[model samples]
Target: MRPSTDIDPAIPLRARDGDVEAFAELVEFFHVRCLRYARYMLGEEEDAEEAVQDTFVRVYDHLGQFRPDARFEPWLFRILANRCRTVRERRRRRESLVTTGELPAVAAEAEGMSQDLLEEVEAALEELPAEQREAFLLRHVEDLSYEDMAVITGVRLSALRMRVKRACDTLRIRLKEER
Candidate 1:
């Protein structure tokens, strides 16, 4: 059965029931959005792309268990976030193992292209802790509400609010320092 919001309700239900065509339709609908979220969270383009693909696989495996009443995007996002966390943990382990090495460089053109406003915002966002960064990106960049963020991050609404607030404060401080 298609979710009510979907243009074609039958497709999702069919997909949920193991129809390949219906599943493919769902993939086409959500793929780009998932990739954008992955990119914003992971920061590495290649890693982000991998994360998106991983998310799709997980979603496919678990889709049969999804509640019909629940919204689809949050379920997908939870998978994405879990994948991102795994990638980040692996990176941390590698970082601890490595000796000193040249850090990844931002392209000169990227830096030159950014105005002060953009630079300050980007710098401040980079300063946030991972959870807070995810909260901020979901809330502002992706335009998700606090409730949706709570679902996506598997946090309570109050905790999501706090994370977003902390992210904002950190951004403000970093931006002020840049001025």
Candidate 2:
């Protein structure tokens, strides 16, 4: 299940003040969603977990750097997204040096569907360019606004919108072909 995206104002305030409990609360709150996004972006459980863990550590270390006026969710996601990108880059580098027989795992768990359809959808998602996939997942799955996505991804609003549009179009065509 996806975690609620709501940010409690007090949590960040307390966390920034070096309250360990508050930081733990923040981790508990954002962990699921971060893991979900990382898993989809990296396509491996171990990589996803590592990314999420790294994200939290960075978040804690940089808590004092957070702007009080800025919304916390976007800032948190921005960090998580960067971690995912780094992990992806590392995996790419490693793959070049050594060929592996591992397959990309499903980004999200699924149920009550034909296994073939699930696999097909996962394959389609994997085929998308990284930017498109991130755009699609952030906009559709995470339900973030274009402005928030721009802040998190550092992409211009127009470019992010175009990426989401292209991602949706691609997914529709690919899934339709599979039918």
Candidate 3:
């Protein structure tokens, strides 16, 4: 489902114009959602935090490059997604040095969610390829439109639709087996 944020487009514009409070406002506005998305993308709290931190830093550094007429969410997500990829790559290289069986912690625990169900779902998610998981989270979790996802991911609309469909089908089957 879509997030509840009713963003004011001019905030980023103000930040682009070197307004310090506006920059902080931008960070405050998107921080939670960005953290959640980053957690899903990176699969760890620390990595997600780093990705979000790096994203805001990059956004702050390149505010002048932001297009005044553009939608801020997609642009911001584009940066965050790239940061996630970078962080994930680094983790892969590090994992080659050490091994662990621990699963990444959930970003946030929903009330009334059973531990068994959360574990099953997390295990299922970890099974999917990164592209499929990314597509699924972007489409279903973030509720971004295909056009926005296209911009954020640099993937074609048809391919994204296919990815989401595949992800849904896979999750449906995997979760069903748990019942």
Q: Which candidate number maximizes lDDT?
A: 2
Task: List candidate 1 segments past 4 Å from native.
Answer: 1-11, 93-116
TM-score of the candidate numbered 1?
A: 0.76
Q: Which residues of candidate 3, in runs, are more than 4 Å off?
A: 1-6, 93-113
lDDT of the structure predicted as candidate 1: 0.73
Q: Write the per-residue lDDT of candidate 3 for residues 1-179, one digit (tens) a residue.
A: 55544379999999999999999998998998798788776777788889999999999999999988898999999999999999998886533212133543453355566668777776787778889989998888888888999999999999999999999999989999997
**lDDT, each prediction:** 0.73, 0.85, 0.84
Per-prediction TM-score: 0.76, 0.86, 0.86
Expressed as tens digits, the lDDT of each residue in 88-179 for candidate 2 is 99886533212124543453344556767777777888888999999998998888888999999999999999999999899999999999
Please provide, for model 1 over 95-127, each residue's C-alpha lDDT reduced to its tens digit, 9 standing for 90 to 100. Answer: 222112232336434766445566456556655
Q: Which ten contiguous residues of candidate 3 have the minimum total lDDT?
A: 94-103
> Candidate 2: RMSD over Cα atoms?
4.2
Runs in model 2 lying further than 4 Å from the true structure: 1-4, 93-113
Candidate 2 at 153: error in angstroms? 1.0
Superposed Cα deviation of residue 113, candidate 1 (Å): 10
